[model samples]
Target chain A: MQDLGIRVLLEGNNMIRLLDGLWVTVRISLLAVVISIVMGILLGMVMTLKNPVTKALTRIYLEFIRIMPQLVLLFLIYFGAAKAFNIHISGELSAVIVFTLWGTAEMGDLVRGALISIPKHQYDSSAALGLTGIQIYRYIIIPQTLRRLIPLAINLVTRMIKTTSLIVLIGVVEVLKVGQQIIEASRYTAPSAALWIYGTVFFLYFIVCFPISKLSGKLEKRWQN
Target chain B: MSKTDYLLEIKNLEKSFEGGTKVLKDFSFSVQTGEVVVILGPSGCGKSTLLRCINGLEPIQAGTILLDGQSITDGKTKWSQIRQKIGMVFQSYDLFPHMTVFENILLGPLKVQGRTREEAGIAGEKLLERVGLLEKKDAYPRQLSGGQKQRVAIVRALMMEPEIMLFDEVTAALDPEMVREVLDVILELARGGMTMLIVTHEMQFARAIADRILFLDEGQIVESAAPEDFFGHPETERAQRFLNIFQFEK
Candidate 1:
């Protein structure tokens, strides 16, 4: 019975380590999302310009981001590019770089969809008012587009946080990675320890993501009805 | 007065759509200073196209549009300068939805003329009062009825202090009860001696307000005369048929 009590206490220490890892994961995701939104709005606006070559380049970029899996992108940035360029990037830094690239592409597409959904008559009316292109964008276009973009972007942030778990594969000591290490260290004392540690990790992710998901749902419902 | 002394002149204007539909061909006319010219035509007759070309919103394939004797369509024409002197109001109010009534009216002056916020504000308030929308200055376009929105659009155009103003069916979008309110504002503008070219379907407005009227058909001016002469005894069969359409409804 004393041996059983020590095993349970050991499992509790693993749960604490996993929680610490989750803090790192959330930190990286929040920073990446902020950077992505800024880059995405600028890139999306440039993509909508009348230049054919720029438009084609942005199309190719969006397609590449869409087709390449995030894991492959992570490895390419962490292992391949870092070596080829002789640059030293920590696992956390590489995870941020890869996720920022991915999130920017997704956010930019959302911005494009939001911008195009605005009626063309809006432009016509602004032009009729003798508003130049810059005034039209500043006074009329951007505010409306941003208002429609907020909920979608919040949903993307939640997606980014969830996807951050995949970064553990690149050897970042995030929540799942810490959980795995804990289970590996305790394999001898308690075989059932893996289930408890992983269950705790699942709840940790849900705790971070559930509130954002609920916020998105409420905003969508409010806007729709 | 010589035609060259007119406030605006259009010569040999031609426009075509991408699908090869010829909308306007060799359309030409002129408006004198302080004159209200009502352009009468059926739908798809290039009336709106003419207004757009004059404002430099739609580029003409071939033409010369001179405002105050300076050619606006010449390759050397400076758009920003010419646009500063001319203002356009659409059938759809097109008030900036994101802005309050006061901001909407002040945008043109503040941006184009580089008026300070305080200067634009004073001018904006007066224009709003003229349009009888001063109390709704804090309201957005979505908050106002269609007629009120149209009035805001007119005031927004006027805040630029344009040398000439174009009205493209301003009352066409208003409810019948609201039409008179917009027309009353327009008549007051006419009495103020502003140079104006209005495209409208309101026959009574043409009869009561316009100094002269031009009847267009198939993108060509079929007749041009004083409103009394044109409405009383139209020369062309097209003008007669055009006037007949307005009569049939009433």
Candidate 2:
């Protein structure tokens, strides 16, 4: 048990490396979430327009992103596209790009669902009250949409944070990658290190995600009232 | 009546659904300034569609709608500008559920017309007071009873200071006991000499408030007469049959 490499995390600056990895994971996820929300909201609004061309184009893009797995998308950006296009994309940048692509599609669909779920009478009533299209959206539609959107978006943020572990596959050195490094380095001296290191990684992810899930649940309940 | 005296006029109005189901064909009517005109019809007879067309909520295929002598149905017409002068209340109330009653009323004046919150608030208070809902100004639509929601909806329209008001069966969705409160608001507006085109099923309220009643059938006005004449002695066979349904309900 003493050789189990739990000491590797508790003994020295090994834990500091894990904290640094956690920071990197959080930074990428945050950047992705912010960019996704802005782009996704604009795309979602475009999807709501009655124009056939825009509707078809957005539908295709949404389906493409949704159907493709995130890991494949990351590899395409990092390895496949880099070789095909002769562009030197860094692993971190590729991870950010892939996660943002995934998040934006999801966020856009959420926004579209929220916007369309509004009753037709609401639009008719606002128009009859003399509101212009922009005014109708600003004063009536958006306020209602945001109320239905925030909790769902927060859930997406949690999902994005968890999915960041996949970045380690492409050599980004996130928390999971750092845990693998620690386990590999102690393989001979601490033969049982794999279980301890992986357990810590799991604990780290839970600590980050559990509070967010709780917050999302709280928001859902508050909005229902 | 002269053209100048008419607050609203619909000439040869034609409306069809997406699949080419003709809802209104060659429908023509006019409401005089300060007169209360009530429209009565069976469901799907285009009474609601007619009101929606006049408010530009539903675009007409071919027609001319003149509001205060301006061609509202013309291609160049700015519908938002025309809607400012024409207030409309629907059967569903359609109050913004997320907003308080005061916010709902003030939205038109503040957002569309660009008035200050205080200015809209003052006018909103007056309308709320008139409807006896001054205290409910802070309450949301979900908190209000069906009658209160309808009354607040009326006040929301009135906040815009519209020249002509349209009611598309505003009390139709209410409970039987709650219907009178909404009708009372419409009656008050009529007595105040507001120009109104109302669609309703309440025969007693229509008799009390309407200067003229248009009985519609098959998307056309089968009979147009005073409320007493329409109720007591319907002119057309379709009108008599429509009235008989109400008689049976009574």
Candidate 3:
């Protein structure tokens, strides 16, 4: 019988290493989320462009990003493309690039949905006030769009944080990978250490993601009412 | 038409939809300064179309709309500058849902007129007071009733300080109890000497407040007269029948 008691917390060094790994995971997700939001807003605007050629090009890119698996994307950028193009890409850089690409496609879809959901009369009213194109966007369009996009954007951040665990499959030492390494080292001492370390890692992820989900829900309810 | 004498002059204005169905054909009218003109028409009579064309919202297929001796349809006119002097109110009370009543009123003045925040706020507060909605200045459009929304929309347009105001059936969407409140605001605006053009089905309000009434049917103004004359003795048989239909409803 394995004693899954306070022995889990008896190892201070192990807990410190786990926390360090968790910090790295958070840093990558935060950087990727910011970059993705900026890129997504620009791409979403381009998606709404009236030119057929540009619209078709953006559509193809969106479809490509949607269908490809995130791990596959990581492998392609890290292994396939880097080898094919004779460029050196590190594991961490590849993880960031893959997550950014995935996050951007999803965020861009959110932005487009929010922008199109505004009532048509809003545009007409802005024009009726004799506003120029730039003024309309600055004063009328962006403000209303941002009001709607904030809650959804926060939700996307929580998703991006959880998805960062997938980067461990490609050799980045995130929290999950740190747990794996600890269990492998302790396998001779206790065969069930794998279950204990991985369970701690799962609780760590829950702790990190739950606050953001709560915040988003609260904001959505407050704004909607 | 005498140039430099009229505030606005329309000559044979015509417009058609995609399939070449004419909406306005050979329409002509003129308005002098401070004149209140009411366009009394049934539904889909091109009255709103005529108002939209004068404000440059819709392009005319043929004919010229002259504003202060300059033609608006010449393809060289700066519509934004021309539109700065004209304000319009729609039937649906299209207020910005995300903005407070005060922000909605000040947006035009601050953005278009380049007024400072202090100046815009002063003007906005005064306009809100004029509409009797000063208490609701910080409320969003969703918080207001239908009549309050229309009144805020009116104040927002008035904040532009336009020389001419266009009302496209402003009270058509309000409840019976709410209709008089909006009409009262419009009646006050007319009394204050705004160059106004209105389209309405409320004949009693038209009779009470209109300086001159024009009866439009199909696409043309079949009769134009003062309120007493147009209501007392309509000239054409079509005009007589149109008036008689309303009379039978009463």
Candidate 4:
């Protein structure tokens, strides 16, 4: 264990700081994911409208997000936009904001696919039963869309958790950054510490994401059959 | 206009797609109370479209549809409210797959009509019993056969207690052995004086159940006559040709 340099993380609250940093990543991811789900569902509904203007607008927004990388977005929001717009945003806040924007776009597109996949007859049958527009959505449209969406959305959650690593580049002091700090501080004393620190970080991510993807797979198998 | 004796009336209906292909043109028809009118036509002859128009599924270009002497399609009453009075069953049963058989019937009565669950449950059970599907009330749609699903669809429509029912080839999706069971349910509804307008390819079933058969061709009604008169001696060459596709035995 000493040769592998696991000894460095054992010294001087390094593990504690890493765990605290993990907490930051989890908190930001959870907040952004919750908001993304709520706003994404509404955005998805709007995207499905028959209006050409709304369609074009949502299409542009989705394409912009898909085309631009998340790291560039983080830089734009954290550094460039903060200076230009005169908003004194914190590192954590900037990370959350950038992540929410990315997550919402992905979740909204997922919802749009789920909504459009439902056949036209479902709406017709609901209307023919005297269900109002809202009632049709509440009873028929939403229930079915959710069934088709939940498995895909669960996979998105794991993605968001893994992507939270990028927050370190924005100077958010997340898990990866904490590992780097531990490695830098012990470079001379524990020359091979980088391997163990990075390996521990990898295990940390697996611990968070493995169960979620497994759950998604089980749900998909059950629902499909 | 004074109150007409007809329960449902549609006049001067002209329906066209955005591409300017007209599906219905100047179509006028009326049904008295307790009447069962079966419409027969070649594929794409506006039989289904006419039913869809009456049920407020399709917007009409220039037409008036009145139910119980009140204009329904003139944008006066809400279509959701008016739709309760015009129950429609589609080619596929369209039962909400997530819901059970009883829940599908109860959804309209409970949510739209705002009836108590106890009242709707009793009525739902009775309707299911009438269609001989009481045992399957707790079953989801995927568990049922196609005929069983269509029967549930008819019961679902009937639960709304509409003034008229419109069936757009409700049995078209069923197998040959299954079609009889579905048609028999509609036949029972006809015998019990449940007013309906059916669009079906089953010629024998059409003759057996229709009080008046409207033979349609190219979005126009070529012949509207009593079942015997229309089936025995159709009035127009178009309707005769429409009938010639089938070699009617009985």
Instruction: Estimate, for each residue in A143-190, the C-alpha lDDT of model 3 and write its tens digit.
Output: 889879988999889988998888897788989988888877766666
Candidate ranking under DockQ, highest first, comes to 2, 4, 3, 1
Per model, kept true contacts as a fraction are 0.38, 0.79, 0.48, 0.79
Write one digit per residue (lDDT tens) for candidate 2, span B1-250: 2358778888999999899999999988888999999999999999999999998899789989888777887777688988989999999999998888988898889877989998788888888999999999898898999999999999999999999999999888899999989999989999899999999999899899999999888798888999899888888888888888867542
Deviation in Å, model 2, residue B118 alpha carbon: 3.6
Error of 1 at A124 (Å): 3.9
| Per-prediction DockQ | 0.35, 0.67, 0.44, 0.59
Error of 4 at B36 (Å): 1.7
lDDT of 2 by residue, A40-99 (tens): 998889989999999999999899998998999999999998899999899999988998
Enumerate residue pairs that collide in model 1: none
**Candidate 2 has what TM-score?**
0.89
The iRMS of the candidates, in order, is 3.2, 1.2, 1.7, 1.6
Worst 10 residues of 4 chain B by lDDT: B241-250
Show where candidate 1 strays beyond 4 Å: A1-16, A27-39, A46-101, A128-130, A168-172, A183-225, B1-4, B75-77
Estimate, for each residue in B35-146, the C-alpha lDDT of model 4 and write its tens digit.
9999999998989989998988898999899899888887879999999988899998999988999999999999999999999999999999999999999998989999
RMSD to the true structure for each prediction, in A, is 4.6, 3.0, 3.4, 3.1
Q: List the residue pairs that clash in candidate 2.
A: none
Model 3: per-residue lDDT, tens digit, B104-206? 8888888788899998898888888888999999998999999999999989888888888889888999998999999999999888988889999888999
